[model samples]
Target: MAAPVPPPTEPDASARICPGDQIGPCAACHRPTHKYGRGARSPLCEYCDAKAVERLGRKLRAD
Candidate 1:
Protein backbone atom coordinates (compact mmCIF):
# COMPACT_ATOMS: atom_id res chain seq x y z
CA MET A 1 0.00 0.00 0.00
CA ALA A 2 1.09 3.53 -0.67
CA ALA A 3 0.85 6.48 1.68
CA PRO A 4 -1.95 8.90 0.92
CA VAL A 5 -1.49 12.61 0.60
CA PRO A 6 -3.86 15.00 2.29
CA PRO A 7 -6.07 17.20 0.14
CA PRO A 8 -4.78 20.69 -0.49
CA THR A 9 -5.97 23.36 1.90
CA GLU A 10 -6.22 27.04 1.10
CA PRO A 11 -4.34 29.49 3.23
CA ASP A 12 -6.58 31.36 5.70
CA ALA A 13 -9.25 28.79 4.98
CA SER A 14 -9.64 28.17 8.67
CA ALA A 15 -11.49 31.46 8.86
CA ARG A 16 -13.85 30.48 6.09
CA ILE A 17 -17.35 31.11 7.33
CA CYS A 18 -19.38 31.11 4.18
CA PRO A 19 -21.69 28.66 2.41
CA GLY A 20 -21.37 29.48 -1.29
CA ASP A 21 -17.64 29.96 -0.95
CA GLN A 22 -17.09 26.28 -0.48
CA ILE A 23 -16.15 24.77 -3.78
CA GLY A 24 -16.34 21.24 -5.22
CA PRO A 25 -18.45 18.74 -3.29
CA CYS A 26 -18.52 21.00 -0.25
CA ALA A 27 -19.91 23.94 -2.19
CA ALA A 28 -23.20 25.18 -0.79
CA CYS A 29 -26.08 27.33 -2.03
CA HIS A 30 -25.48 30.17 0.44
CA ARG A 31 -22.82 31.72 2.63
CA PRO A 32 -22.77 33.50 5.98
CA THR A 33 -22.32 37.22 6.59
CA HIS A 34 -18.80 38.63 6.72
CA LYS A 35 -18.69 39.98 10.20
CA TYR A 36 -15.85 41.01 12.54
CA GLY A 37 -13.64 42.10 9.67
CA ARG A 38 -12.98 41.42 6.02
CA GLY A 39 -10.18 38.90 6.68
CA ALA A 40 -11.91 37.29 9.64
CA ARG A 41 -14.69 35.81 7.54
CA SER A 42 -14.95 33.85 4.36
CA PRO A 43 -16.30 35.57 1.29
CA LEU A 44 -18.33 33.67 -1.27
CA CYS A 45 -17.99 34.31 -4.95
CA GLU A 46 -19.69 37.64 -5.53
CA TYR A 47 -21.90 36.39 -8.32
CA CYS A 48 -23.18 33.35 -6.43
CA ASP A 49 -23.87 35.21 -3.21
CA ALA A 50 -25.57 38.12 -4.87
CA LYS A 51 -27.86 35.98 -6.97
CA ALA A 52 -28.82 33.65 -4.16
CA VAL A 53 -29.56 36.48 -1.79
CA GLU A 54 -31.60 38.31 -4.38
CA ARG A 55 -33.71 35.29 -5.20
CA LEU A 56 -34.22 34.40 -1.57
CA GLY A 57 -35.22 37.91 -0.67
CA ARG A 58 -37.69 38.05 -3.53
CA LYS A 59 -39.22 34.74 -2.54
CA LEU A 60 -39.64 35.84 1.04
CA ARG A 61 -41.21 39.15 0.04
CA ALA A 62 -43.59 37.42 -2.33
CA ASP A 63 -44.74 35.12 0.42
Candidate 2:
Protein backbone atom coordinates (compact mmCIF):
# COMPACT_ATOMS: atom_id res chain seq x y z
CA MET A 1 0.00 0.00 0.00
CA ALA A 2 1.13 3.57 -0.66
CA ALA A 3 0.95 6.49 1.74
CA PRO A 4 -1.51 9.28 1.12
CA VAL A 5 -0.10 12.48 -0.28
CA PRO A 6 -0.32 15.69 1.71
CA PRO A 7 -2.06 18.79 0.44
CA PRO A 8 0.01 21.58 -1.03
CA THR A 9 1.19 24.11 1.55
CA GLU A 10 1.01 27.86 1.05
CA PRO A 11 4.14 29.90 0.91
CA ASP A 12 5.09 31.85 4.04
CA ALA A 13 4.27 35.56 4.34
CA SER A 14 7.90 36.44 3.88
CA ALA A 15 7.86 34.63 0.58
CA ARG A 16 5.08 36.90 -0.62
CA ILE A 17 6.71 40.27 -0.12
CA CYS A 18 8.81 42.54 2.04
CA PRO A 19 8.85 46.17 3.05
CA GLY A 20 10.09 48.75 0.49
CA ASP A 21 9.66 46.14 -2.29
CA GLN A 22 8.63 47.27 -5.75
CA ILE A 23 5.40 46.09 -7.41
CA GLY A 24 5.01 45.20 -11.09
CA PRO A 25 3.12 42.96 -13.44
CA CYS A 26 4.26 39.40 -13.80
CA ALA A 27 5.99 38.70 -17.09
CA ALA A 28 4.21 35.36 -17.52
CA CYS A 29 0.78 35.84 -15.88
CA HIS A 30 0.43 39.60 -16.27
CA ARG A 31 -0.76 39.84 -12.67
CA PRO A 32 0.53 42.34 -10.11
CA THR A 33 3.55 40.98 -8.24
CA HIS A 34 5.96 42.24 -5.65
CA LYS A 35 9.58 42.45 -6.62
CA TYR A 36 11.72 40.68 -4.04
CA GLY A 37 15.09 39.04 -4.30
CA ARG A 38 15.33 36.99 -7.48
CA GLY A 39 11.65 37.69 -8.19
CA ALA A 40 12.74 41.21 -9.16
CA ARG A 41 14.64 39.73 -12.06
CA SER A 42 11.95 37.29 -13.25
CA PRO A 43 8.86 39.42 -12.49
CA LEU A 44 6.75 36.32 -11.74
CA CYS A 45 3.96 36.41 -9.18
CA GLU A 46 4.05 34.18 -6.12
CA TYR A 47 1.51 31.80 -7.63
CA CYS A 48 3.41 31.52 -10.90
CA ASP A 49 6.70 31.12 -9.04
CA ALA A 50 5.29 28.29 -6.98
CA LYS A 51 3.93 26.57 -10.06
CA ALA A 52 7.24 26.95 -11.79
CA VAL A 53 9.12 25.48 -8.82
CA GLU A 54 6.71 22.55 -8.71
CA ARG A 55 7.18 21.90 -12.43
CA LEU A 56 10.95 22.04 -12.14
CA GLY A 57 10.93 19.70 -9.18
CA ARG A 58 8.85 17.18 -11.10
CA LYS A 59 11.13 17.39 -14.10
CA LEU A 60 14.25 16.95 -11.98
CA ARG A 61 12.76 13.96 -10.15
CA ALA A 62 11.86 12.31 -13.45
CA ASP A 63 15.44 12.52 -14.63
User: Which lDDT tens digits does candidate 1 get at residues 1-63?
Assistant: 944422334322323554444333213323332333333433443444445677786454323
Of candidate 1, the 10-residue stretch with the lowest lDDT total is: 24-33
**Candidate 1 wrongly placed segments (more than 4 Å):** 1-43, 58-63
Q: Rate the local accuracy (lDDT) of all candidates.
A: 0.38, 0.54
Task: Itemize residue pairs with steric clashes in candidate 1.
Answer: 19-31
Q: Quote model 1's TM-score.
A: 0.24
Q: For residues 1-63, write the lDDT of model 2, one tens digit per residue.
A: 844422224333343565535655566665655665544665656566667778786454323
Give residue 19's lDDT in candidate 1 (0 to 100): 46
Candidate number of the best lDDT? 2
- RMSD (Å) of each candidate, 1 decimal: 12.3, 7.8
**CA error at residue 29 for candidate 1, angstroms:** 9.5
